[model samples]
Target: MANLLDQLKSYTTVVSDTGDINSIKKYKPTDATTNPSLIAAAAQMPEYQSIVDDCLLAARKQLGTAATDEQVAAAAFKSLAVAFGKKILEIVPGRVSTEVDARLSFDTEGTLAAARDIIAQYNAAGITNDHVLVKVASTWEGIKAAEILEKEGIHCNLTLLFGLHQAIACAEAKVTLISPFVGRILDWYKKDTGKDYHGAEDPGVESVTEIFYYYKHFGYKTQVMGASFRNTGEITELAGCDLLTIAPKLLEELQTTEGTLPLKLDASKAAAMNIDKIPMDKATFDAMHEKNRMAKDKLQEGIDGFSKALVDLEALLAKRVAELNVAV
Candidate 1:
């Protein structure tokens, strides 16, 4: 019998949900995703230090001698994610999701600018946009920005998505992918209801399943990638999703566990269900956002968390650059 990992892969495209290259290599996921938090964690590793150092030096040179260390650190922040994405692309045979600054979640122009810069950097490195998925928060503004980017041949991954409205908007915009977070949804429900959820009953699992059914029912082309899993059970429950971005530890569990992983989410099954389609314009999106407490709170909280991680990474870059200068 095949292990769960291999069995799961036959049903869904597995994506590594960390910036650690070694973990990605061990699991061999089809794709990899990195957010500010993951990139910050990987920056501390000795093997990845050189990637950070190179970004700092390049930022310094680009800005010239008039630039202060603080300015260089700020400048290097964007490239750090791309640098990590570039490295991840070398390992994964599929796309690598490099996030736009989460601070730009509500700023359409700012998100577009950051996303363009990220893609430009990858292009300069000879990595085509096909191998890169610029990740943006699934705010109304973010979705609109991605809509524009998509027409220009840039693919996007709408993330921090907690509700169906966000998913529908992303699909309507024709973005390449939407990352509906599974574990985070469960986190919110578990805390709010003060109860435990397991197996197919997990709220996170249900959320993705709903979105999957909606998409398949409407015949929307935007792919759904179930992300941010808390356990292997959550992972198994999402089998046959378009994709699942899993952390390394859970990937290890699936790799070692032997079982018949039956397909839990099938497009054919979703298409046959009686799912209602929600119109997802900015007004509708806003109305839904205001109505869904879990989506609103979790979206804001996820942005704040990622922004903090970016701030910490910038501070680390500044300190490392200072030490490098002293050594010279």
Candidate 2:
């Protein structure tokens, strides 16, 4: 039998979900994803210190002694995103999904503006759209922003998606890709029922399976990439998704294990499933959004967490900028 990673790749495109270049290089996934959390973690790594230092130097050069910590932090984030994108591209032949500020999830206009800024930063660094997917939250506003961005030839990866309404909205908006969080869904269900889920019966696994079958049945062009994994079982359960973005820890587990990793999902199986394709208008979308409690709470929670992290990162950057000034 082929290696499990190779076998998994045969059906689903594997995406590395971290800013750690060494891990990505080791696993050699087809694509990679990065967000504020991952970038912040990478920024603290000694090996990636140069990346942050370079960004700090550039910010100082631009703003001189008056540069605020927040501004410096923004520059550091941009610098780190671009640096990660460059490294990811060298390993994955497909694309790298880099997220905009989660703080902008509810602010459609702000999200659009930030996405354009991120892409421009990448372009300035010689990375093109052909290898970049700007990650946005799957909020109604975020989807609308992505819709417009896609029209301008910028592709988006919709993340933090939990509900079918989110997926339906992304499909309607014609997003480049949608990351339906698998592990998070399982977590919600586990908490709700106060019982552990197992194997294919897991709610998280079932959620992605439903989304996958629906996308195929309706011929939706938006790619489905499962994200936010908790364990190897969640990863294996979603074996045949369009793509699966995994953390470095899980990737190492998969790489080391030897087992008969069979094809759990296929186009033929998806095609055979009889599922009604419900077209989502504003009313239906709103109703569906309200009904899914897990999706609703999680979306809000994720946005809030990401927004706060961005603020914290900005504070850290500002302190660094102040130190640089004092040194000069």
Candidate 3:
């Protein structure tokens, strides 16, 4: 009997949701994703110190002595992200998701510029946009930015998505992929009602199921990747999703356990289900998003958390630059 992880992979594309290079080698997911949080965490590990130090040195040399500390630090932060992304790309044959600055979640032009800049950095390193997925928060502006970039041959991964409205918007924008957080949704419901939930009854599972059905029912091409899972059950429940970005811990659990993982989500099954197609225009999107408190709150929280992680990475880089300067 195959492990549950292998069983799940038969039905869905598995994505490693981490910046840890060792874990990526161990799990061997089809694709891998990294945000500020994962990168920041990896930067703190002794094994990854050289990666961060090398990027910091390159960033300092590129900016020269005239650049301010903030400028140098910002340059290094972006460099570190791309540096990690390039390494991940080397390991995964499919695609690697590198996220934009979370602070630009509401700025369409800003997000667009950042996406282009990141893609340019990747290209300079001999990696094309086809191997990269620029991850953006699922704000209206972020969706708009994705829409513009998609037409220009730059692919996007709409992250921190929590609602059907966000999924609909991404589909309408023709974005490359959308990551709907399954565990985070469950966390919100658990905190709100103070009750534990599991399996099919979990709010997170229900949310992804609904979005999966909606996308397939409407014949949308944008991929729906369930993410931020809390348990193996959540991952199993979403077995037949387009993709599943899972953390290392859950991946290990699935790998060690043997079970019959049934396919819970099938596009063909979704297409046959009775589901209504909603027009995802700007007005409708905003209105519907406003009505879903859990989605709205979680989206903002995810952005803020990622922004903080970026800030922490910048501070760490600045400290490293200072230490190197003192040694000189």
Candidate 4:
């Protein structure tokens, strides 16, 4: 039997969710995704150190000696995103989703500016939107920003998504794709109930399945890309999704398995479901978000974690700048 990766490809597009090039080369996912946390982790790796150094050098050249720590850090991040995207593109024949600063989750203007900067960097490096998807948080502001970006021919991948409201919002905005987080939902439920979920009944799996069905049922053009997977079980459960972004570890785990992978989601079947499509306005979206305690808490937590990681990355870049100054 072929590897699980190959099997999954038959049903859904497999995306590598890492900033590590070696992992992408190993699993050869059809697409790839990167965030601040993943890029920070990759920066610490010896193999990726050169990319950091290059970024630092570029920052110094552009910002000059008087650039503030925050400016230097931002430049380094943009450089790292571009570098990782270039390397990943060499291995994967499909698109890569590079995220904006999580700190800009609620700031539509800031998110748009950062997104434009990221895309500009990619374009300078000769990568087009055809192979790039700017990843943004699925907040109301972020979704609206994505709507504008999509019109400009720059596709988006809405990440940190949880509830049906978020999905509906993304579809309404006409985002190119939405990554409903599967593993994080599982984590939330496990922590809330203090029990391990098993098999197909997992909350994460259920969440993505429901979102996938709704998108298909309503003829929403927004692609459902399941992400933040915790295990192969959750991934396999969402096999027939538009796309699934898997971490390096999970991708490796899937590559080792060689058995029958069953199909769990079908768009045609989903379209046949007896469900009415509901439009989500500001008032409705707010009410739904307030009702879903899980979504509310998880969204805040995700934002906080990403913000903290961004701070840590900035500190690392500051240290690098200090060292570079001493050398100069």
Candidate 5:
């Protein structure tokens, strides 16, 4: 009998949700994703030290010897993500998701500039936009920026999404992908309601299921990738999603477990179901965002978390530059 991982991959494209290149190789996901936190985590690994040093050296070279450690770190922070994406792209057959700095989540212009800069780095490395999905938070500004990037032939993956409104907005924007966090949503519900969820009953699983149905039913081209899973149950429950970016641990569990992974979500059934469509724009997005407390809180929290991780990475690089006494 084939393992669950192989079965799941048969119906849904499995994406690795970490920056660890070895894990990507081990699990062999079609696509891989990385955010500031994952990149920071990977940067600390001894195996990845050379990658970090090279990015810092390149940044220092660009800025000249007069650049402070702080300046060098900031520049390297921008390059580090694309650097990791480049490595992951070497392994994954499909596109790799490299995120914009989370601090720019609310700044559409900053996000746009950062995304363009990331894409430019990849381009310089001989990787085109087709091989990458510039990931951004699902803020209205982020979605708007992605909408423009899409028009320019650059693809985007809108992350930290928790509400139907955000999903609708991304679909309307025609962004290439949307990563609805399944585990985080479950965490919020478990904390707020004080009830343990099981399998299909899991709030996180239900959330992504609704999103998968909504996207297929509405004929949205934007792909839904269920991400940040907490358990194998949530994973198996969302068996037939368009994609599911899973953690290495869960991937390992699925790889060893033998079971028939059923196709839980079907596009044809979703298309036939009666699901109301909401008109999405800046105003509607804002209103719906304001109304959905879970989405608003989680979006802000996810941004803050990712922003802090970026800050920590910058500091680590700064310290490295100082320790090495890097000059020119």
Candidate 6:
């Protein structure tokens, strides 16, 4: 019998949710994803120091000696992200998800420009937009940006998704994929209600299951990828999701544990479940999302957290660039 990881792979695409190259190599995920936090963590590591330094050097050559420190840092950050994406592509046969700037989560045009810019960088490096998933926060503005980008042939992965409102919006917008965070939802519920959850009873698992059913029941083309898992049980519970981006620790657990992982959420079953079709018009969507206090708070928190991570990366890059200049 195959390990749990191989069994899960038989049902869904397993994506490595970390920015660490070693973890990606270890798990051998079909797809890989990186966010501000993960990328920032990698930037601080000695293993990734060459990636940072190379990006800074190239940024200097492109921006010239007179470029401002801000300009160099900005260019370096963008390069660092694509550099990681390129490296991940070398390992994974499937796509790599690189995120848009989190600070632009609320600005539609800004998000579009940033998304296009990232894709352009990937294209410049000979990777097509089809191979890259531009990750954006699931805010209305971010969804709108994705909608526009999708039309232009750039695929998007909507992240920080917490509620039906966000999921419906992404589906209606025709995004390539939506990552409904399972563990984060569980975290919120466990803290709010003081109950430890497992398997089908887990709120995070329930959320993703609801989203999977909703998307399937309505015949939406957008794929649902459950993410941010706190335990192996949550992953097992979402067995039939379109994809699941798991961190390396959980991947290791799944690899070592041998068991029969059942298909818990099937599209065929979902299609026959008699669920209500959600109205995703702008006003209705806004109201529903606002009413879901957990979703609203967590969405803001995710954006803020990613924003801080990006800022931290920027600071780290700026410091590295300064040190290199001093050495020169």
My TM-score estimates for the predictions, one after another, are 0.98, 0.95, 0.98, 0.96, 0.98, 0.98
Q: Which of 3 and 6 is the better model by lDDT?
A: 6
Please, what are the lDDT tens digits per residue for candidate 4 over residues 245-274? 999899888889899898888888976698
Supply candidate 1's per-residue lDDT for 254: 96
2 against 4, candidate with superior TM-score: 4
Tens digits of per-residue lDDT for model 5, 1-328: 9999999988999999999999999999999999889999999999999999998888889999899989988888889988899999989999999999889999999999999998999999999889999999999999999999999999999999999899999999999999999999999998999999998899888888898898898888999999999899999998889999999999999999997889898888986799888888789899998998888899999999998998898899999988767443
Q: Which stretches of model 2 miss by more than 4 angstroms?
A: none
Q: Which digits, one per residue and each the tens of the lDDT, describe model 1 over residues 1-328?
A: 8999999999999999999999998999999998899999999999999999999999989998798888899998879999989888889999999999999999999999999999999999999999999999999999999999999999999999999899999999999999998899999998999999999999999999998889889898999999999999999998999999999999999999998999999788765687666776788899999999999999999999999999899899999879877876
- Candidate 3 on 1-328: residue-level lDDT in tens? 8999999999999999999999999999999999899999999999998998888778779989888767777788877888999999889999999999999999999999999999999999999889999999999999999999999999999999999999999999999999999999999999999999989999999999998888888888999999999999999999899999999999999999996889898788765688777877889998998999999999999999999998888898888888777776
Supply the global lDDT for candidate 6: 0.93
Q: Report clash pairs, candidate 1.
A: none
Candidate 2 structure quality by residue, lDDT tens digits, 1-328: 5566777877789999999989988898988998888877787788977777778888767776576667776677666677778867888888998888898898999999989988998888788887899999998889999999999989999999998889989998999999988888888988899999988998888888888888887888999999999998888888888899999898888888888887776767766778887888778888898999999988888888877877776776677667766877
Worst 10 residues of 6 by lDDT: 270-279
Clashes of each: 0, 1, 0, 0, 0, 0
TM-score result, candidate 1:
0.98
- Model 4 is weakest, by summed lDDT over 10 consecutive residues, at 73-82
Please rank every candidate by lDDT, starting with the best: 1, 6, 5, 3, 4, 2
Give model 5's TM-score versus the native structure. 0.98
Displacement of residue 54 (Cα, Å) in model 5 is 0.5
Between candidates 2 and 3, the TM-score winner: 3
